[model samples]
Target: METQDGAELCFPQLFNTSCKKPSSSTTQAIILYTVMSCVSLLIVALNLLVIISVSHFRRLHTPTNILLLSLAVSDCLVGILIWPGEVFMTTNCWFLGNLTCVIFMFVSIIIISSSVGNMVLISIDRYVAICDPLHYPTRITVSRVKLCVCMCWLCSIPYNSLILKENLTHPGRYNSCHGECVIVINPISGVVDLVLTFIFPITVIIVLYMRVFVVAVSQARAMRSHITGVTLQLSATQTTKKSELKAARTLGVLVVVFLISFCPYYIFSVAGDNSYTSSAGFFVFHMLFLNSCVNPVIYALFYPWFRKAVKLIVTAQILQRGSFEANIL
Candidate 1:
């Protein structure tokens, strides 16, 4: 009986100090592993297409595409690092040590915070493009957007490090036993994280998008009423307006989907949820992970340029000389 019980412990030699193995049946664990593996691969592959599409095609190198590229980079990291880490936590012990666990925690927080920052920046971009088109060309240049993306990432590292400072200084402080990896955010830090990372960014995104939507609808109505007769210059202006409106609609969908995926995790965390072992916590986490996969799908479904670029990429046409000069838009 002692031998059999020892087999259930994550570190048999540790005896009383070791964590017990997870209790799920082998079949269920296998199914979960398979599903998560496929999702991780899909996330990486799709985001890679987005990254290449925006980077290789000069025509797609607009300010908005630059923001999308930054987002895809963050999402790809989610698949490359976070997914594998979560899977390992699910199926095995954290034998990698407390330092590794804290590092993973820090990196994951950086990714999450950067994603929120990107969403806020995208919202601001759309707002300027739609609500202040005259100044947008001067205001939202590619160079400016790239700088903002860099600042977003650079700021994330320090911000999250501050939030996880306790865990960083005392790795594995929250672990109940050997073979466990955990981090606890005290109530004070949790409130700060909730406000800055969740509430503040979300509020800004919602407000900017709301203003963009209102302006877009008004512009669309104006264009319809003025459709009868116009000079060539006025017609071209109308065409630009139409394209801006279409982009607003597409990005509106993106923001809504992001909120749907992200809100549950924050909500559950606020409700005092502690462990991903619980069904509710499990669902919340996977919902958040699914967002990274769903974003590239949104791009494919809404952006004609994305579809055209993907076709070129998959057909090996992108390898041809002068492909960067190809007209993707």
Candidate 2:
């Protein structure tokens, strides 16, 4: 009888202090694992492709693609580091101990917040490109963009370190039993996190994109109505305007999808973190993670350069010496 009972415990040796294995059925657990594993793998593969495509192609090293590449790196970590840990924790006991848990939380927070930072940079890039095209060349140079991305990441390290300091110092104080890992931010800290991670970044993104949308529409109408110059210089300028307009529309779609995916997760935080492991919570969390995977798909759908880059990457043509200078544009 004791042997049979022991089989159900997460840490059978420490019966009183240990959590029991979750009561989900074997088949159900298999299905959930299978599905989540696939999602995690797909996220890794897609984001890896984005990272490789942008990094390998010299022609794709524009300010805008630089931001996307930064975002892809953040998303790739989400796929590689965050989601797998989440999946393991959902159906299995925490076997890695408290230090690993603290590190996991710290890294997850950095990856997510930095992804939001990238989006804000992207919004600013689009805004400048559309509303102030004349100065964009100087204002949004590749060097400046690289500097911003670096600062965003460096700031994230300290910011998340501060937010997670309690967990790091105190370790697993919130866990009710062995075989479990939990991090608790009190109400005040939770409010601060919600504001910092969601409210401020999202506000900037929405406000900038709203301005971009207005400016892009007006510019598109102006381009349509005033098409007189057929000179080579004029033609190049017109083509540049058309390209900028299309890019704005594409990025606008990406931002909308990002908001939709992440809103539920933040809204849940606002409501209280009580439901974080509930069914609704699980769904929203997965949805938020899914945004990482969806970003590259958005690129594939809207950016022909991305499609061509992928072709070159997959066919191994990028291994050639002159591949970097290929006319991806």
Candidate 3:
């Protein structure tokens, strides 16, 4: 009995007060940790490349790319801070103390919320470019985009601070025993989070993308049918329309992938089964984290500029003087 209890407890020395170890077998735990560690490293490395690519190349500094940069920054934080912390929590006891746990949760929420905000900004940017191309040049300037990115991040702090207020005031209040860390979102806060973060943002993204799609399709049809006379003026208009449509398609993919990654967590939350200890919750939370890893991958697939930037970065050609002015687009 003593041996069995010792084996199950996270901290054997704590005896009666200790939390139980996860029921996973030794091999399973080892495999999970190894996979998570590799993913952590990959997420950090990939997003770091994105950060460098966008930041270094001057020609890539368009309004849409600015939104991507903000997203990369938030995703990089997830890789650098959130993934490793998750790995540690999954495999070990809560040795970091309640204060540290609370701080970790706070930072994690802020980064995630900032990511969602960046996605919304991206959608809005694409909407203007596709739906209102006449004013896109003036409306979506670099300085304005930079300001929006700053606001997205700054607003996330206060927004998430409110969501995690219970944890802030009383860290570890939900812990069942020593060597454990957990957060329990009461129904009111959970509902508010669901509506604000998941439901509202997703609704806006879908609606905007739907409009973008309609406009893009109509523009494509116009170009194909040669509805307008084929003067040099018409040719120029066609080229511009094609560019806008392509951007919309690429950004549409980005938004769709983000929704795919984010929806599971909220869905489970709404089902009232988002217990942190449960397997489904664990999987969904990591699914959300995986979005950070996949964003640059999507960029590489759809954006030739990202591919070119990666090549320059990997070859160390970006180190040369005036490389920032390279024609990445």
Task: List lDDT for all candidates, in order.
Answer: 0.89, 0.85, 0.86
Tens digit of lDDT per residue, candidate 1, span 219-304? 99999999988889999999999998888898889889999988997898688753344557657767887899999999999999
Judged by lDDT, which candidate is best? 1
How many clashing pairs does model 1 include?
Answer: 0
In model 3, state the lDDT of residue 207: 96
C-alpha RMSD by candidate, in order: 1.7, 2.1, 1.9
Q: Which stretches of candidate 2 lie over 4 Å from their true place?
A: 1-7, 228-232, 274-276
Best TM-score goes to which candidate? 1
lDDT of 2 by residue, 1-329 (tens): 12355447778788778877777888999898898889888999999999998888888989999999998998888888888887777678888998998788778778878888888999999999998999999999999999999999999998877777788898787888887767776777788878888999999999999898888788777777767756788778889999998999999998899889888888987888732345676677688899999999999999999999989989999999999889988
Q: Which of the two candidates, 1 or 3, achieves a greater TM-score against the reference?
A: 1
Ranking of predictions according to lDDT? 1, 3, 2
Worst 10 residues of 1 by lDDT: 273-282
- Residue 132 Cα positional deviation in candidate 2, in Å, after optimal superposition: 0.9
RMSD of 3: 1.9
User: In candidate 3, what are the lDDT values of residues 80-165, reduced to their tens digit?
Assistant: 89888876776677788988988987898788788888889999998999899999999999999999999988988888788888
Number of clashing pairs per prediction, in order: 0, 0, 0
